[model samples]
Target chain A: MSDVSSRDRKQSWFYTDIVKEHFFHPKNFMDRDVATDEYDATGKVGSPACGDELRVWLKVDPGSERIREFRWKTFGCGSAIASTSVASVMVTENGGMTLEEARALKPMDIMNRLGGLPARKFHCSVLCDKALRDAINDFYRRAGRFDRIVVEASRVVDLVAKVTDHDIEEAVLEGAHTLEAVQQKTKVGIGNPGVLPAVEDLIRFYREKYFG
Target chain B: MATRHVYLDHAAAAPLDSRVLRSMRPFLEGAGGNPSSFHGDGKEAKDALDDARTRIASLIHARPDEILFTSGGTESDNLAVLGYARANKANGCHLVTSAFEHPAVLESVGHLEKKEGFTATYVSPGRDGIVSADDAIAAVRPDTVLVSVMLANNEIGTIQPVADIGKRLKKLREAGHTKAVLHTDACQGAGAMELDVEKLRVELLTINGGKIYGPKGIGALYAKRGVKLQPLQFGGTQERGIRPGTENVAGAVGLATALEISSEIREAENARLIALRDTLIGGLLARVPKSRLNGHATLRLPNNANLSFLDMEGEALLLYLDAAGIEASTGSACTSAALEPSHVILSLGLPYEVAHGSLRFSLGRATTEADVDYVLDTLPPLVQKLRAISPVRVDEKYYV
Candidate 1:
């Protein structure tokens, strides 16, 4: 028998303010009228047998990008519930970063806030944060205006560059038919230079690059 | 509006009362002398130890001297089963116990069979999770030295008729066979239920601190004065040489304090818990279809509500509920982590999927009607969500 445990049992691991708050008065968790910018993610933590689950919700803005609102739904330990309680403030107050960034958060910050979690259940804090991020990602995906897109715009400078690239073309080129036929029979649409042939080549390039 | 935090799952462990805490403080801070030492300090410690023994004995209706303080239920069970099996090996090695016994008993029995030359019979409980005294009596061979049964199951909270089993053993002893001893791990029963050893007729009993809201890491084994159990450890003459080394006076005081308070509250707690427990359980059954309650409902503990939701993993539901801010357990906690079906549920012959999804809610002092209501309101949707994702599914063919 280990006569004395390191912790004072009189003040059980459950007596801490955070544990009581989590176990007694959890906050920020009614989502019926929650907004669209909620950084959506899915949190499916705990085992198939242990029966603990946590889902967190965070709403960050694209402009000033501060967490506008935060909430969660937790179904397990007091520490896990407290983790959500503490995490909501952490993510929302810290200028709500990207959902991915929130997903990557660590639990030590929560440990510091809640005093600390029981050594056996440190994962509850991690689950809380992960659930929030998962919900955030899920929320955005549902919104359609979620992923960022980048496309190129055209300019006249590119058109001039294309003309210069054909100046040193091959010696013999075709018109109307094959380049060999043009060379053997007659000069067709070889503009005073080779504008028509260059246009045809440009059309083929465009077709291969995009239209195809 | 405000709500109460439902404190179900008390069978997991309970909260110590102010009275218990008040009784424990002095021992933890002041009563620091070694009971083995023979000074004024030692005398004070010895007196305190005696007081705890007497209190524990009074709760169980056993003799004070029979109480051999150990650490907790696991140690007491090991000392009782392994110690007795090893000591009486010459008499015969056949031991019989139920399949739904706590791991403390089942695992220890396994060690004796594997390490020592002993044969064990694992009796099965019926579909209602009740073991017949006749069945256990029948398993008792002429050579059998011991029979260990739990007063109440820790997970499902099925209260085994250990008193009845003890009576049968007593009858057998009165006729001829006097070698066999009956032991029960009553750590779960000590607090919320009556624990009169004389009424139960148990020769050896297991009582632990943590389960009864005392400090953890302390417990006692009740070894009837003449019941021979081999010593598992050796060091000093402490605890009558049965358990050696320096004693845990603080823990004992705390345990005694907790036990005393628990005894006082037993009746009131039982009534309150049963009423709230029925609501928590009955609500789930009514709201969630295709869910089954495991174990004998009325014969079970006042606070125990073990349920098996069809076509789902208890862990998945647990995680879902966790996110929802409702605390609960899935059968045995460690068994849940293993992702394997619980041995208790499996012993009941449930399908592996149902076994995997078994949940137990043990209500305690902190539990409230609001908490029960919260669970009732929150759980079924979670079950539905999980059923949607279950790999091993149940539809019209399986939902009964």
Candidate 2:
């Protein structure tokens, strides 16, 4: 118990020096009113209603199949801004990551580059990775490579509303802990009793995954 | 180079006044024994405690013996809501309060509902952030035992119509329609508003030292005569056995001095703060596009200026302001450990995006016009930068 408490005390500061540096002095952020033709593809993720949103503008080299420029903007916390900033650097640094490499980039990689975030802020890192994948998918869609687009693994829980497991996870990350609370946000398993058990399992899984 | 520092989160805590500190110096320097002791030193301590109680009571126009000291606003609120409800359970098990009350009162009432078999109705405030007296009174039933509301909201600083609510409740009692007692957390109002217990007609009133430029960790609850309350803590007879513990002598002294000083200078200071608050609010609205003020325009506390900028999260804005040496607060979920935005902002029927985008700048005694202008000059660029980065469009309306 003492060991855990001492470790927590050492990491009490909300942001690391790197995170602070990135948040205060972000890199490669797109300025307001950038020409639409400047970036080949743009992808956005998260919702303003959830108190976080990220938009990534990607300029990919078609011949090399590598990311040439990665600029982004976010309406989120310090951790979200810093994570996106650092992730932008990670993908575009040293001749930039290939499309495949960028797609394989995980939230852990961004967190590792950030020297780790608070347990609650782990979800913020997840947003940037998802947004980067979305940008990659957008690039592929624009290139008419429909087969190259990688869809996220999400099961539809609410058939009528098409609320997916990803929606439930996002709801949980937004502080909906209980079944009723999660239902309020996503409207999952309400009138669809057959999916109730699955929704419960997903809520438990998400609660442990992000919170623990 | 040293950055220019400007403090604007006075709603969180005010800097302790040196005069109040001087008043508490004797107690801190070991001038007397505990008030509970029977020795000569103890008698001196008791006298000092009595003096503090008298001065504090006089500030609110209550009898000296009606004042009960506790650890702080939380404890006083807990004692009033929990204590009063439990003691009068035989009378009624129902309570009424506003949806946007401080967690101290809300949690206590919640505890009663969850664990103690009590029922409660939480009346939501209007979009203007004022809890209508009619709505509050309408929620009170014959079985309602207590009603808790705040004198002034700590977030948006909208003043509640507790006096009007209290008068209606009194009328109900006179007509034998209900037996409910009125309570108001006046911690935020103690520094600015005239807190006459007679005019407010609150049976239980809570005032904290921290908000009035006094010391922290000390608060008093004014319980009208003949009001029944069960003790939250068990101990020897102290605070009439309702709040039994060793007295915080220095804290009491400091709180009394602070309240006295605040009462003396409130009118002039309020006028000055109103002008500055208006300048800050008006300047921000003019300079920053798609910004709207939160809470009532003219009915809010003189020092509070809460505004929401579109398409940007408040925590990120606060961080940029902090880097620029401007201290403020936010209603963003990211700022709190609970990951929930400000309940006060949400209680106004605003959307989550608006709540997430809210910022509060509460000025205090040492605030100057230059400080307000500094914020005016600093905040616009920061908001623009954040908005430029935000995915939410400037032309889109997040809330209807």
Candidate 3:
């Protein structure tokens, strides 16, 4: 169901000119050559046959690892596009090393930044989190600066968050295998990827009730 | 009329025809009487009710005496399944049905299990949404008392191999399983597909009148003569006492009239609506990015276009379309607010992501190419807007 934006939709082509001056258009990038500390997260959300995909493309600096740039191309609906835009820009402006620096960034944060997207479109920001991490990794990988890649608290939290039996030995081994590698080692056949919540809860239950 | 509203949910209910209205007008006014009363008006109502029963019986190829008027498909389904199973519990306590059947049949089966102590073996249709009659027959146990597979599905619109089921039931009967009553909820098949009680080889058949351009709250269950079903409720000696209360004369007349018209014009109408429906559905796929069509396309109803717009919740899509003045439904109307998606869609084994984004546009007598075109012109951009803010729009690499 392709169509208009909320108040974003112009009453007429005459109203289109007014909308453009306020919001970004279907035109060029929003400040493609932006200031330092831009968020670089890329999200490709949907499939043409089934649904949409988004890629959050954000760039974090190697040394400071602060976000430097953010941009993306979205394929699904206007809500997805708007979500990506808000996330990319907010991460760029607020991203840094301090906990408070990126504190303002979240799905709701992204939504609110764009004068709020439809509640259904909140799922669009899943890519925002991943893109932010990938961008930081990409920046470090590009600069050839780091002696070793440091998997952050933010990135590691995606199912690999806990410092458990697996993470303890794996973390000491010095990037022997990626988090995905460890997950495969620990988990059985991949069923629902999102069943991570249930898996995490199960693992926690076993640790606290039995092992602890 | 110069203008028409989109009426695609015919499986849910059809627009009452002018002719059906014409036939029922007298019954609503001058012909009002208890068909059992000893009076001229009573005799007139009785004649009308009998005539309607005969007409319905003729259309479905059943004896008029075997036909029983019901409140609608739900009641007919309940009576045929639970009624038959409970009455014959001494012989067998088990029943069987397909997982793809409408809730009218499935829920009735569930009730039989819960209340009447009847065990139901629900046979699953594979991913293609087609149930092999062989599989249904295989699920039959020695204790199976009835097999109630729907003739056609209200969702995917797949017609079951009903005739094959009937023949198998006959074979089982010959081998001494004669107590197993074969019943089908044919509510979706009345106007969209063929219906013949004998041809389908079932002991009982259920159909709804509103689904075929007749009055609402009217349906019939064809329990073949001597099928031996116990009635669920005590009633006056109406509808041969199987279904009771004052006869709904207007509803009966309307249903009979609708059945005649639908039987006569079904083929031509199917061809026309199918063309227009296909054009609309096909166009939506081409123009809308990330649009997926749900259900078996060719095997589906003439006017159904079920779609899922990924990365967007179906509820949002329905809301946006409402603002755009195009009305439609997401999955079953009964379960829409639950955010659980349609069980019909889920039974196909599609993921929750696909299920949440599902939409069904059922075509009716009034669907037109222009209406579809108008929809085509309007729907895509709404999808684009919703998709923009969606988060899970990314790629994942999987290892085999």
Candidate 4:
């Protein structure tokens, strides 16, 4: 409490003016009614329960295999929304990016383009790149290339105890009714309170299905 | 694009009223010397302080000497809870409070329980976020020495049954149980409700100037005569030595002036605010599907409407609303920056995501029908836009 000044704490919660501008006026967010088939591939990352989730869809031209258009949907904070907004613009700025160029796009590139996010919200930038990579993986999967399926270890519930969503589900199946009960069963949220939001979501999800 | 910046976060703090400023100008500029001094300038200052005290005392139906000035509502709250508990410790160390109390009261009660040898009972609110009198009464023990409840919740705007709770405690004392002091943080309610402390049956009541369009630095605690209290601070004997600091003369004048004006105009302003509040609440619920009103529909503060927009993060929605010049609060004003979902909302048995998706729009003197219409016009499209990008499926009956 002594380390952080009240003014600094208040300022840290705000996005840079540029980030706010992009967030308020996002570039190419997907329409809810847009058909799944409209995009060549789709990539998804994070979970709503984790308090951040993003999905990116890309329409690639068959001739050049260059990404012709990008659209996305996200359930996250201001930084995550702004990061996704800027990333979409970065990838589609000069007519389009070749699939390789899109693949090379990094979280730093997105963060730098948006001025910057708060240090605690750096993970929001990371989610933008992960979602894009997942989209590329989807692009490969749709082209009958089973070998290109990059099974990134994205399914993590507790980083400290190395607990996964599957483990949380198993514990819930054994009648873990609350977050505390699930922690007793699988030690999911005990190590990281940061992950408890996600853990709580999974507990509810599983309990609704199994207990109901 | 509308350039008008509509302020609807009045519960966070209201802009100081111009009338209050006019009342405070002489005290700020020419009214010199400390109220404690005995010189000519000091006599002038003392007169101002005495006049302010009388006006403030009259506003709440208390005698002038019962009012003790502190920095603000937080200090007033700290004084009432900590002071009362410590002074009466020989009698008992038991305290009672609601689970949804503001942090000032909560943290003070927390410190007493953790560091001081005190026991506490936290009564949870009913589903509508109102503390039931029965629940509060049931939590009272024979040894309970202090019961602190806010007159109105700052976040959800739910008015507690503080009067009823006070009556019950009055009964308990009449029955020869421990003489527990009933305290209410009337910071948020002083502007919106009737605040006759004697009528409310509260022994100690808190009022801050900021929420009532007075100055920000001044708050007053009304301790009923003969209520034993230990000072939280020590220095020269100001505020009867309970809060020993040089009196903020201009602040006292501003606070008293604000209170006097509030009582004069409360009825008309309350009617106007209640109408605007209903329009905003009704419009949002009607225009935005899946939007749910938080807190008790009828028992809430007239100017407050807390609503949860399904499938959108509150901070994200707040930014969108902020961009459109519609200022609002997500959760309590103090903790909104910390970004944890509101514990007050969660205490109402709301799912966390629903809590996370909530916004509080508190109308004030500046709010107009046009402002309400502008918000109704602006907010629905933004909610639609956010829901489009949201990963949480509204159809997932579990999330709702």
Ranking of predictions according to lDDT:
2, 4, 1, 3
lDDT tens digits by residue: candidate 4, B298-371: 89999999998878777777777777888886742112333345778778877656766778898999889999
**Tens digit per residue, CA lDDT, model 4, A145-211:** 8786666554876654445687678778877688766664444443247888988998999899898
Better of 2 and 3 by TM-score: 2
Give TM-scores for every candidate, taking all chains together and pairing residue i with residue i. Answer: 0.66, 0.90, 0.68, 0.84
Report the lDDT of model 3 for residue B141: 75
Best by TM-score: 2
Instruction: Please provide, for model 2 over B1-400, each residue's C-alpha lDDT reduced to its tens digit, 9 standing for 90 to 100.
Output: 1178998888888899999999998889975599988898888888889999999988889999899999989889999999999999977999999999988999899999999999999999999999999999999999999999999998899999999999999999999999999999998888999999999999999999998999999999999999999999997789999888899988999999999999999999999999999999999989998899999999999999999998898888888887788888888766654456678877898877788888989899989999999999999998988887776774445553
**lDDT tens digits by residue: candidate 3, A1-212:** 11111221221112222222222333223323334344433323233222334444555564575656656554433444445555655665655342224433555565555564433233322244444444445555556746433455532322322223433243324231333333333221122345456445545544454445
Query: Which ten contiguous residues of candidate 1 chain B have the minimum total lDDT?
Result: B331-340
Ranking by TM-score: 2, 4, 3, 1
- Scored by lDDT, the top model is 2
Q: What is the per-residue lDDT of model 2 for residues A99-132, given as tens digits with 9 covering 90 to 100?
A: 8999999888999999988766675334788788
**Going through the candidates in order, what is the number of backbone clashes in each?**
44, 0, 65, 0
- Report the CA-based lDDT of candidate 3 relative to the real structure: 0.64
